[model samples]
Target: MRRVIMLRALVWSVLLFVVSFGCAQERDPIVRIQANALSKAFFVGDLKDPTDDPEFYLRATVVDVASGAGSDGLFTNSDAQPTVRVRFEITEDMLLARLTYERID
Candidate 1:
């Protein structure tokens, strides 16, 4: 009886572990700021659509961009190629953080 219970407990624990691991949340994709959006926003005092070259624009305005989970599906994916979403934030010190850059693929 003891052996049977121990085996059952082990199997249950393994099953639970597998299920939890499988359901684990994946880390968000890395966001590479070709150009800093926050700096541009602060300097320009408005958001400029750098549809022409995001990497260049972002790199220029990359004061400090923060990272957070957000879906890119809300807006059109025409600006950032392969970037389905972007993780970013603007700090009080007027910094733009481009922490994660995700590709649609």
Candidate 2:
């Protein structure tokens, strides 16, 4: 009983650490991309975690400087999707990007 309790505690601790650190990274890129270009960033909005697809997507919004419009983008940690490290920068105006990822469950 004591060993089981200790194992559970360890798992919870590791999960907490990852949640606090990894999910809260601030890497907001450009905000506007006009005329086949990108937007300048005034500020970045908060990161939103996946709801139905919790294991798949990390959603965030960038505010466009020119039009004050928000462009929502998805960041995935999955290997199937483009790695977030190289693809984090939103340099193009993808205002009408279609939802490519759907709920698996």
lDDT of each: 0.52, 0.44
Q: Judged by TM-score, which candidate is best?
A: 1
What would the per-residue lDDT of candidate 2 be over residues 23-102, giving only the tens digit for each residue? 88788997664675522221112223223221223344333344654433322223235422111222355422224345
What RMSD, rounded to one decimal, does every model reach?
19.2, 23.1
Off by over 4 Å in 1: 27-92, 95-105
| Candidate 2 residue pairs that clash | 32-38, 32-39, 33-37, 33-38, 33-39
**lDDT: which candidate is best?**
1
Q: What is the TM-score of each candidate against the true structure?
A: 0.30, 0.25
Residue 22 miss distance in model 1 (angstroms): 0.4
lDDT of 2: 0.44
